[model samples]
Target: MENAAWYVLPNEADIETPSLIFYVDRIKENIRLLINMIDDKSRLRPHVKTHKCIEVTQLLLHAGIKKFKCATIAEAEMLGLSGADDVLLAYQPVGANILRFIKLIKQFPNTNFSCLVDDFKVAAQLAEQASAEDCIIQIYIDLNVGMNRTGVLVNEATALFKQLSKLKNLSMIGLHAYDGHIHDSEMRVRKEKSKPIIEILKNLSKELEEIGGRKLNIVAGGTPTFPIYAKETDFDCSPGTFVLWDKGYQDAYSEQPFLPAALVISRVISQPAKELICLDLGYKAVASEKPLLNRVFFLNAPELHVESQSEEHLVLSDTKSHSYKIGTVLYGLPYHICPTVALYEKAVILDADGNIQYWDIIARKRKITI
Candidate 1:
């Protein structure tokens, strides 16, 4: 069979309104496509914060994905408890999370857990906690390639790496440079912009290596610049949205060879006027991060204009004369799938053989069993 322009799930009638539906076959295909793109399984350390479900994590683990990156300590704890081999807390842990991070390391001794540290004081604090528990934790030096969100500047990387090297209980493993800012619509433009950032990371890594007297592993890039970084064999590519592709990235980067694997299944709740209708897809159901016009793309109703949205309802104006029944089901592709997945407690998984299953968003919360 050729590539499907559109994907349809089984048992559409049985699916309830305002439900998160995941195409299992499509998700598997997405994973396969990403692996093929990189051509090396070890290079793909996908982020689990996109799905936050143990079932999805197991699928990746079964597919030989031994390493993963997560944002929250809860996500890291889940991966550790699930027996993940290498789990990286991509975000720098601070405050109480530093203690929680230490607890996770002690809780699962078999699982190798590491974290990102951009600040020297934070790294020192983590070392103090780990030393108190008599545990050693690995940490990557987060470099600011461009995002400027949560990483050390390239010039400041050496000083911080030196400070981290002095810590007794903390091992400075590598560098993590996230280029989330280089998201150009044109593939060529995006790759061209990524070149300088990747060069900065390489230069910083070389400097840190010269000072620390060892080779440093580098992790870089998100979904937008994943294809660009795939060319750099030295960098471990962490692209999360590739697992469940969304319209936002797909539309922006048309050359990306992935399909939308997650969609919001909603039903028409009422018809207030001839051209106006309200859907059960409220802000609570889908992510409302983007502008109102680009919140979601209707798979069935292409001309559906989102007029307004409340907590429990999305008012839309159907420009076309096609009439939809009150219970007519509609599939919506969310612009941002990461936050959208978090809004739901569980997802309705549609498998290849038309089988239906429920997968709980286990790591959606901020806390995990200490």
Candidate 2:
């Protein structure tokens, strides 16, 4: 317990319950580890969806990570706020988002921006909006590489890429393949799955260059597949969770030595029964998308199992017969840090000197002056 007490703050007197705690030292070490993982930092376009704070973005920018990928406009604008070198809005923006994206491009001219397009209609609409705004929008053809979520299939995507090349305000600059479905715990299986996806992207890139007469860039993979893609010279990797890792990834990928930098601080608010104690941590505090026990693992209280959870209360059942008082503090590691991070407005930052500060989770908001 003493050796693994890096997450424990010097004092929990000022912190509120169910709040987020970030260790700057661990985050800095994680950033250093990420930089040392790859040979060339230029090919690294880390996703900013994990820690959506401008301070963290500035940390990455300071650590020499220029290119970044994000899922929302507010994140893009947050990167814009930090003057990131190249930013990719990985999601396909539609309807009013197109204008908001264009506004982002116009607002942050210092930061070059691009987006993903899986459908031709969305691409054309984007091009029309860009034309109306009198600006060009760079895009990547989002490929469906077994994710089966948003990307277009390879066979139809080539023709669509050629078709979109004729559009005036659109520039088909790259091929983006997000193999998010390949998160097997075994490294061998993960490597086996990523090989085919890499081959397809390479072949498609060659075909696009030969036929469309424009060289294309490829940015693919996330935290799960980042290590596999890091070895590839051609494909860039955008891993988000490496910045502030969680229990889910740590338990899944033992090969990745990133430290758990972020945690949720919760105190026991009530003791309803002999073995059942309720903590202030709840669905509103942590990511509740996973199962009851899979959401958050108590770092200090391994004997506690999550019995139930509600909007503002998380009830846990004790097994080891450890006596816990009402105000006992429990530090937790979230299974899914991305969604868990979104629940907090400000992260209680713990520095190396045990100093406590606040950093706004800026991109948690849907709109940040986009």
Residue 221 of model 2 has an lDDT of 94
- Candidate 2 lDDT over 144-175, as tens digits, reads 99989988899898788878888889988899
What are the clashing pairs of model 2?
none
lDDT of each: 0.87, 0.91
Q: Model 2 scores what on Cα lDDT?
A: 0.91
Tell me how candidate 1 scores on lDDT: 0.87
Clashing pairs in 1: none
Kindly provide the TM-score of model 1 when superposed on the true structure, using C-alpha atoms: 0.96
Error of 1 at 82 (Å): 3.0
**lDDT for position 45 in model 1:** 89
